[model samples]
Target chain A: MSEIINSPLLWKGAVVTLQLTLYSAVLALILAFFFGLLGSSRHGWARAIGRFYVEFFRGLPALVLMFWFFYSLPLVGIRFETMVAGVLALGLNYGAYGAEVVRGSINAVPTAQYEATVALNMLPRQRMWRVLLPQAVPLMLPPFGNLLIELLKATAIVSLITISDLMFRAQQLRASTGKGTEVFLVVLVMYFVMAQILQLLIRYLERRSERILGRRPRRRAATAIAGTTGTGSLSGVGGEGS
Target chain B: MPSSDTMSEVPTPEDPQGAPMDKTAADGALPHGSTPGIRFEKVVKRFGDNIVLRELNFTVAPGERVTLIGPSGSGKTTILRLLMTLEKLDDGVIWIGDRPLWHMPRGDGLAPANEKHLHEMRKQVGMVFQQFNLFPNMNVLRNLIEGPVRVLGLSKDEAVERARELLDMVGLVDKIDAHPTQLSGGQQQRVAIARALAMQPKVLLLDEVTSALDPELVVGVQDLLRDIARASDLTLLCVTHEMHFAKDISDRVLMFDKGQIVEEGPPEQIFGEPTEQRTRDFLQAILAT
Candidate 1:
């Protein structure tokens, strides 16, 4: 147990997981914003293109894309590092989903606001940044928070591609200590702890955004400073099927 | 339906009323700043199968207060939209002073005026919408400053100073930092009016600017509009259901029906003893009280 805690290999695994999640999520954000904007634009061709991207990438399982990016790219002379391949797969897969959230939030801006910009004679770009985007922020935040956590957890799958990660550390502990129960349990608890912390950060940011929107907070939520969140991160997945 | 009282011997070349019309309001327009803004020259507009303006013609002298009244869809709001360039006329031209606002010369010959021309023209025209479409996300001060800063290129200090003056003018100084949702309907319209005034337009369009207000709240807004119109050289074009407000503020009244002007004259001639049965019937239904 003491050796596992002191091992530089364990730290390397954890660091790699964190780096992969951070870099991939940032890349996904860029893709999501542009895809979202295109998905909601007036041009029929662009919207159709955005729609196709969203459906294809979102429908393709992340693990399959990971396998494809790692194994298939080498045959095409597109060989890349294991970490680069992992982040690319994660970014492409998650980007399609984020595009939907972006599109829906932007569409939700009232038409009257658009007309008002027309009355102002705003340039197309000015209308987008000044009017459309600000209205979109509060609507975009909640869904995006869920995506962030999903991206974080999905980093675990990169371990299959031989990229060291937290899951790799768990396997190392299980093999050496020969205590699958204790080692696996510690890793699971660590994941639960990380997810709960992220969930708390999202709620905090959501509260801050809501306050800026001038919405009055509801009873129980307004009072709590630190609250544990259920796994049902996006909408109702946390509730039991039973 | 040109009122008989408007008959003249000068023979102002009859605007080929029967000709094929497209953007008739696009020509013979009054010059902006140099002349009183806003002119219509036999303007004809159609929406698909419906003709909304039938060789319609009118002008507002600088600082003139004019009110447009008619049944719903009488094309009153359409006229304002045309001036604001929100809608392109099917026939005829509209001019602000000497600047041709409705059309830009294109290789296709004459295209609808492009955005840059429209922005320059719009700088001289401000409108308050019926819905009081204030930016819901911004405070009153930012709302007033956005167009002046971005569209007109006014400095922030200058914009805020002007915004402050306009807020005080609208009796909303206390609410300048408040979000629009916090204000009552009257207050919101007042802020919207200030937002429009911040542009310092030569022609101010008010499209039923107060009809959406609470009944009790209407008086405050009408008074604010009257005060603003009185102090500026704004050619006021108002579309409204408020009969008394129109009579009190207008230099002339244009009565429209089925999208054509049925009668127009000085307020007394049109409102007091309207010559057309359609005008009389419409007025009675509206001003029955």
Candidate 2:
């Protein structure tokens, strides 16, 4: 158990896993907003394209997508590095699910809000950005937090594409030491810790979004203590759902 | 259909005796060379299988304070909504000032107005809703300034200054930084009124603005509206069940029934001696409650 915990190789692999999670999360988030906005768009062609992307990616398993990107694409004269292939597969898959979250959050904004924007003579873009999206932020946070953690867990699948992630390192260590249980258990705890960290980050963002939107009371004391904290971190996924 | 002394020269389509409902009130209150405040030329609006408004022909003279008093589902609120562009007109044209609302000149003929045309027309109008519809995400000050800065192209500082003045007018300056959710229903509605005023709209539509308030709170809002009516040359189209408020504010009171005006005159004639039985019954039922 000590050796499994102490292994420098395992730490390196954990770094690789963390890198995968971060990169894939970023890609997924961009795609999520793109497809989500498109899916609910007034234009039929945009909605069709958005729907097709979401259904296509969501219907396929993340691991199978990784394999296709890694192996099959190369055979068809399209090549990607191992990590790039893994990130793309995970991003495309998770993004589809996140798009639903985005769409649902946007729709959940009251009809009255839209009407008010119209009454104010807001252009379509202004209505979405200024009114609809700001209101939708608090609603999008919790679900996105969940999706982010799910994306974190899904990074384990990158091991199959020979990315040398935490899961892959654990198998290698188990093979060398002939101790499957110890190696697996340590890796499990590592993954769990990473997920917990991600969850805490998301919770912080949810509170920040609520505060900005004035749905929750502004914690003057906390603001004083944590002086000048910027809202840059969650601007994409947590900024506005709708 | 004898014209009231204070009534503007609005063309009355349903008048048995074709009173020249032109832009010439006997009181001479209407300005010369000004466009009609609002005019519906054989307008029709239907919802699904239900016809809400049927060839609703009426006109509100510029700067005239008109009240649409009717029972629920009589299409009084629908008229306000149509002017505000919240509802699509199924047929005919609605003119706001000199411009057609739902249609625009295309070559030698008229076509359905596109978004840009509608937006330009909407800029001249504002509305206060029953629900207040203040943006929950924004504070009172932000709500007031949003339209001015965004749509009216006022500088942020100019918008804020205007917002402060409007907030002061509405008696909500103290609550400027407060969220819409934090204010009472009446306070929220005041903020909504201020928000609308920030746009400096020429035509104001009031759709039961006090209906959603608590009974005790309705009076204050009505008094504020009365003050606004007294102060501005704005064309006011009001839909309210509050007969006393309607009487206080409206120069011409229209009694609507089944999507048509059953009677219209000065407040005294409509309230004291309604020519139509429908108008009498509706007023009796409403006033009794």
In order, the TM-score of chain B in each prediction is: 0.86, 0.89
Per-residue C-alpha lDDT of model 1 across residues B85-116, encoded as one tens digit per residue:
77887887676777667877677556787667
Instruction: Give the winner by DockQ.
Output: 2
TM-score of the B chain in model 2?
Answer: 0.89
lDDT string for model 2 (B203-276, tens) is 88999999999999999999888877766667889999899999988888998877777789889899989888
What local lDDT does model 1 show for residue B186?
A: 94
Candidate 2 C-alpha lDDT tens digits along A191-230: 8999999988987887777777765544543444344555
